[model samples]
Target: MVAVIKSSASIKNVLQYNENKLKQNVAQLIHSGNYGKDTEQLGFTDKIRTLEKLISLNERTKLNAVHISLNFDPSEKLDKETLQKIADTYMRSIGFGNQPYLVYQHHDAGHPHLHVVTTNIQRDGKRIKMQNIGRNQSEKARKEIEKEFKLVQAEAHHLKQAYEIKPVNIQKVQYGKSDTRRAITNVLDVILPTYKYASLPELNAVLKQYNIVADRGKEGSQLYNSKGLMYRILNDKGEKIGIPIKASQIYNKPTLKFLQQKFLQNQTEKQRHKLRIKNAIDFSFVKRPEQSLQELINALQKERIQLVLRQNDKGIIYGLTYIDHQTKCVFNGSDLGKPYSANQIQERCNQQMQRHEQKLTQRPAFKHANEQKQSALTTAEENGITFKIPGVKEVFKELIQTEQEGSLAAELRNDELRRKRRKKLHH
Candidate 1:
């Protein structure tokens, strides 16, 4: 579970995003802590009006907006009532019930999430005390909610799964320098409409026709690649333009056979290209001694390092190497070309050796620590103990066990759960 909070100065613009849809999905009135029944009777618009009225009534500062989102991983098979209870508990724990807060359950995304909007100013015309609250309060809320929900606590700096569209750098290509950027731009533009169901073979065929190649890997059963290239009959903005068709649905050729051949060919070509360039550079360097500096310059130029020459009044020359956008070291011409003194090289090698040893030492230590942590967590979970963040909620095995026991009510929780479970079972 993840909780994100955002503060706004205006409620009008914030709620205006999907006002109509939100209005239609207001589930139940859990609890309104400090505000009155009349205040509760006022709908969202009227609530905003009431807030304004309260501010005017007291001659206090105008009310600003406070928004919070609670995202939960419903993988634990929780029922609708339980889910709502959890959501309500989360809001209450975060100090929203005592304020003018409106909770909305959003069903637009793949996961079940809730959004809460409130005013910083209370009905008594006093602003909710919020200072240095960003980091501390958020962490506190997250910990409490996790414990209450009995969720598997995530690490402090856990690596989140993210979808990134990186440009593929192709060698021996005309736009080699800009190939990645150009490829990303072109692919995004061309394939944006038809990427959902494009099979590996069909994608490869289509890319081959346009001099592009589609790579494939697993995306939770559906195959995808780094490019996220898919074949869908969607319009430019991802709205359904027509029905989508898979490669197998459209083509008669064997998908696996063609992909195997193409993968082999691509790998072979890449290896050959790398070898050819290395050989050419080595041959050129061997043939030209006077142009050694030029060759070295050419070789290192590809790495984005800057080389500067310095000459004294006596005509003695020296070279400086700049790495990491800073001047690293200066060396004489001879030292720059040939290997350094035994002591100098030894020092450099020793530094590298120390780093290597440090890495070697830390790797196993980290691995052991992680293994121990996981083992402890597994044991605790089996013992029905809850693991959670420091300040957020703690989720006990009892909650999960109770949820699982209510499997009959799961069907009525949400249509999405049924669809997802069906898809998982089907695949």
Candidate 2:
């Protein structure tokens, strides 16, 4: 089983999240702790009043709400009773057994997961120390519960689902084709909690894969000034379409402020996965030494690592962001090191192309001799006996240039050179 623990200032938000899910019939209140009646039988007001009453004991603890989720492998066939017991045991192990927490069994995703909502404030007006709770207590409890229940271990479970990111097909959110709010929300529900991205661009690199983009509006705009955010669907051409969904309106409230916090948290989280990307890139090159830029992209994609190239209107690639699906990590090329940066990647591709080009152009003395003989054999009447013997090398060179100069790859190379020249002039 995998576990995620989060603390929030608004217990209502946490409660309402589950409440909304319950209303949608995607979740059910499974068990209650430290309550007189079963949690499933309690009304919304009763559940809120009971938890808030305890939170009011300590005004100093603004973030009193604790939300935890225990995720099981998709193959696991866990009944409600077993899930409740697992939640109960996991909570007790994490020192939340005495708290008036409620467990809700969620059936939204492909996996079997349970959401536990509770408070950290005690009846005596004392607040529980939540620092390192997830890394320390929750991890310990998750492993223990997995063993006790004979369930899939976290490491094993992740490995099992590593390369297979989304088992069920989730079509790209197209404007007007579906509910915009729900479509973006569904994408966020899967992305926000899973991928580790430090910045909006890095996050967007992953979001663009699902045809969704998080828009903070233009600089100096009202939304930008107010630090507001919106999620919008992108068309096949990558243009934004349809009405945008406010970040706050989303179920988990992935606001700009919220994402800023995540940016900090994910920076450290993303570091551990950098080596995986670096290795994958190096391996791709090793696998195909003569591969072009497009071939490299294909090789990386085959490994479930997306190599997103950021290019200008001129089609000059200026940036590279790698998305590792297996590890759920997004990393900029610069973050990986100088070798993986945009400049280096372009230089490498050009050099590889140059090498292959050289190999194809290089000719031994015998070939040159044969070309001279063939040139001599040409007769004026036969349409060969050149009026002025043209150099075979120059003839072939012009033909190669004619073939390459107008090619798409050559245009990209030209843009890259022009960009580099512009930078040089500016510097």
Candidate 3:
């Protein structure tokens, strides 16, 4: 079992966050410790008020709320009772036994995890010093509890998922270059040799989360030809800051040579993840058939795959890369298939645009035809023509009027002929 903890100043926010999961139906309140009632007896609002009242005792500490999540192995299928016991024991072992903490079982992720919401402040208003609490207290408790509970021992491979990287504020790092270097180093130390990436852009997509970039000079430049690379801290805008640090200067020596070897190895190692990347891409298009390139990128990002577009100097996209962060696999778009290639994707985007534009243009023609039909019906009513006959009533009315006029002209000719004969006889 792995324990992850985060501290916040707002008790309401942490309580609402866990309760929101309950609203989503992906979580359940399993155990309420040090509370008057059982988990089933207490309502969500009551739970929040209970924790808040405890935090109110210590008005001096701004960061009083403690949010901790304990993740078990995906292979472990512990029942609610077993999970509750483990949560209670872990809390007591970590010295939060007396504090009022709400235990919630979250089912959103693949593993069985529980979220504990409690405050560091005691009922007597004394603050629990949380300095090194995670390293000193939580780590020791996690090991002992893992053994006692017979849970899967969290291997090194599971460490990254257990403890996520904390993001550094880019704006703050600008004040000191060493802080930027140290921050970059901290991230690279974990990601450089671990995550399988084939190219620089794929690596950047992963580094982007930590506000760091591994940059090679412009194409055909001395640095690019020499296969030299440098690392730089990226600001909020994604622009580089401070002098670029050479890869060789870093203790790990993440040079181009080192990265190239990783690229070659990743080519073979990342094959296992190709199906997952393909499925994610296919699923995105199925969900939103008319999605633009940017929309597709957003959708894939939710699936834990970062799609990076490679463009030329003229701003024409020539290639595509997908960084599957979940599997730590990097694949070139062409490597996936011709369908995932840049040209093919651009074609799909164009087809979607054309379909949308065609619909927009066809709307006016359809509206005009409907309007003309309505106008014809209104004119027929104004001219005393009934349209109930349905078989071209206007044409039938014109034919009837022509026949009646011909018969009347013939009758008037006959009367004129009679009048002429009578005048001749009188003369």
Measured by lDDT, the strongest candidate is 2
Give the candidate order by descending TM-score: 2, 3, 1
Instruction: Name model 3 segments beyond 4 Å from true.
Output: 1-162, 166-168, 219-222, 311-316, 356-427
In each prediction, how many residue pairs overlap at the backbone (N, C-alpha, C within less than 3 A)?
22, 2, 0
lDDT of 2 at 98: 89
State, as a TM-score between 0 and 1, how close model 2 is to the true structure: 0.70
* Per-model TM-score on C-alpha atoms: 0.35, 0.70, 0.48
Q: Report the Cα lDDT for candidate 1.
A: 0.45
Query: Candidate 2: which stretches are off by over 4 Å?
Result: 1-9, 22-27, 36-46, 49-80, 93-96, 106-113, 119-178, 272-276, 283-287, 302-304, 363-427
Task: Answer with 2 or 3, whichever has the higher lDDT.
Answer: 2
lDDT of 3 by residue, 1-427 (tens): 8887766666776787778779999999989899888778998778878878878887878668887889888888899999889988988988899989999999887778999999999888898887668778999988888889887876557754655675556767766635665577658756865578887777887788788889998999999988899998887877888768898766446778767766886777878889998888888878887879999899998998888887777889999888887877877889899999999988987888789767744664444544555676678789987767767776765565455445545655776898999999999
RMSD of each: 31.0, 10.3, 23.9
- lDDT by residue (1-427, candidate 2, tens digit) is 8777776767898899999998999999988899867766798888899999999999987568888878888879999889889988998999988889888999877788888999999989999898668779988998888889999887884645642334112243332455678767656766876788999999999888888899999999999999999998787777887778898887667888888888998899779888888888888777777778889899898889999999998989899999998888998999999999999987888888888778644534334544544553454227643436558646755555455444534555776899999999999
lDDT of 1 by residue, 48-73 (tens): 66445543543443225565666666
Better of 1 and 3 by TM-score: 3
